[model samples]
Target chain A: MNSDSLWEVFINACLINNFVLAYFLGICPFLGVSAKLETASRMGVAVCVVMLVSSICAYFIHRVLQALNAPYLQLIAFIVVIASTVQLVEMFIKKASPTLFRALGIFLPLITSNCAILGVALFQTNKGYDFIQSIVYAFGAGLGFMLALILMAGVREKLALARLPDTVEGTAISLMIAGVLSLSFMGFAGLG
Target chain B: MQPEKPIVIRKEVVRRGSADEFLKGLWRENPVFVQVLGMCPVLAVTNSAINALTMGLATAFVLLLSNLLVSCLRHYIPPQVRIATFILIIATFVTVVDYLIQAISLEIHKSLGAFISLIVVNCLILGRAEAFASRNSIGRSLLDALGMGAGFTFALLCMGGVREILGGGTLFGVALFADNYQPWVVMILPSGGFFTLGAWLLLFNRIKQRQQRKQPRLQARLQEMGSEQ
Candidate 1:
């Protein structure tokens, strides 16, 4: 693997191409948990933890799969590995810190299916990132996800007071807001 | 055990009524718009109108089938093991859809990719199964699933239409303008998703306020007639 600068990898992952905004991964939690800022922030941190661990685990697992010449097993294997890891993490958190667990407990299992986590693993494998790069990319992706969630949460919080129509009150409006955000992100297209 | 009270027994049946319960998912408690149960695919796959249609259809199919089967087998499956069973069933259908899409075209399949498989974890499907389908009949569950699926599809289509038009300067892959038309590339990006959705929210609120203003005037007129009566 070619050695890449950590800062370069970080900037690329976080800003130029975000997981939710650019890559279109982990949008489920981005919208579901983003209804409230408190929950969104907590979920963001939880997801960051999962992304870090999963990225490391997936990098090694991908190497093993490549050695075995069983790339077909990639998707299912990644999902199973992520699911079991989340389970273990959940149990550890439950036993270790009930308070932190309570704050982030419900979101832990949800991370197992978060497309962003798996997407990071897949992207890292495809891009052929080294160990350090994989970790940095994961960190950057998590930060990106957090950035989008926080911005959305802030806007949605203010939207709570707005009198939305009976027909298109919640999801429809949130989606339109997402459309505009997607538009603004275009300004960054020439950055890289 | 003490004899069951008639009111309590009836209350249980009322709560479990299939048709009313199922219909509720369409409007009063729409999984996408009203309840906001599933947001991942709603936001992610809706970049293009066609993608939105396919994703919405796929999700609806999963929701409908899973709800029916889960409701049918609710009695046999123990509560402790129900979630596992539910995931297994949902995953099986997702696998079927995944292969079917692959067979159709690599391009569309590539675009959708893992988001299709992730439908298994979409809170809307599982949430309904646990909360409604587990208790309702096959017929009621089907209607509930249909209603929610359509509602979700409608929402996705709306987002996709706006994004595709502004972002790509086209609709459903057809260019609306000539060579001079320069698409606002941001509309297709991540932040554009946020700002577009936010503006739509504001617009929806404004329309709602206008309607609310009209309602009070109409109510006042009705009250005047009532006073004469």
Candidate 2:
């Protein structure tokens, strides 16, 4: 585990293989909350924190499920764990930072079904990463998601004033921008 | 404790015929384009027509069955446990579909991979089960599910057909262009999925906008004719 090298995991997650652009995870929030830069960054932080915690929990329970030889339990266990973790995180945020809570509170429940958090847990287990590797991978995935969210939010802010055609005003234009962004993310395909 | 009160509620609550219920999903409440629910498959499996079709069928099946079951059990399931029960029901169907796909065709199963299971988390199925099914009659719930399922399938087919034709230079499997035709290439990739859906959404929105613009013109012309008469 010590020799696995965390840099590769970080790079592989953050840039080489992004969650939103590459894997198509967290796209609902990617489109919904990305209308404002501040909101996007807040949601990104919330997702990052939840992803980290869910990864830790998923890694441990996964071992127990493997020992019990109940492979089918993976979906239910991961989802329940993630839902509770989001609840826990939401409470903590409410107590710790009221202002931050206000910004991210609404999106907190939405994170339970984000799929990226669940995707992190599932993919890390699939790759058979060690405990430390799972943590780093989760962190990387979160940061990658955050980066994508921030970038899209910035663009959308600028687009607020642009005069797009009536039909392509909101979701349509956002998707087109995301498509082009996904194309750009493909440039990193050869890095790793 | 008779079934008469429930029937009154059903009759009063659901005024529209089944056909109206079904048509809404196809156009106004389309799961893909209009409501924009279940986008993961909308943008993912649409790289090919056959894959998209298979995925559409699987989702529709799960959706139709789940809606039926949820509607039947709505009165039994307490409101507190409704979400969990819904999740469990959805996961069961997804697992069944996952295994059934593997049994039917290993290649298609392999192609779909984790996404087959991810259908459980799709907002569309849960959204429908919660929003429409839980409160409505079983017959109406069935209509809603079928409409949504067909609308979702129609949207996927549209995306898949365009992507397959442009990206692979083929409709389903047969080659359409010449042997030397230079395919767009990008259409088959992940990015191509985003591009194709985005373009289709743009087209749909433009058509909708044009119609909205015409409605006012027609109204104004009617008023002018009324004054002249």
Q: Report, for all candidates in order, the number of backbone clashes.
A: 33, 0
lDDT of predicted model 2: 0.89
Over A10-35, each residue of candidate 2 has an lDDT whose tens digit, in order, gives: 88898888989878887899999999
DockQ for all models: 0.40, 0.65
Q: Residue by residue across B44-100, what tens digits does model 2's lDDT show?
A: 778889988999999999999999999999999999989888888888888788888
lDDT of 1 by residue, B84-176 (tens): 677777777776777778898789989986778777667788788888789977888788888888878777788789999998988899998
Query: How well does candidate 1 score on lDDT at residue B227?
Result: 100
lDDT of each model, Cα atoms only?
0.79, 0.89
For model 1, residues A38-153, the per-residue Cα lDDT tens digits are 99999998888889988999999998999999865665666667777788878888998899898986788778768788778877887889998999999999998998898889
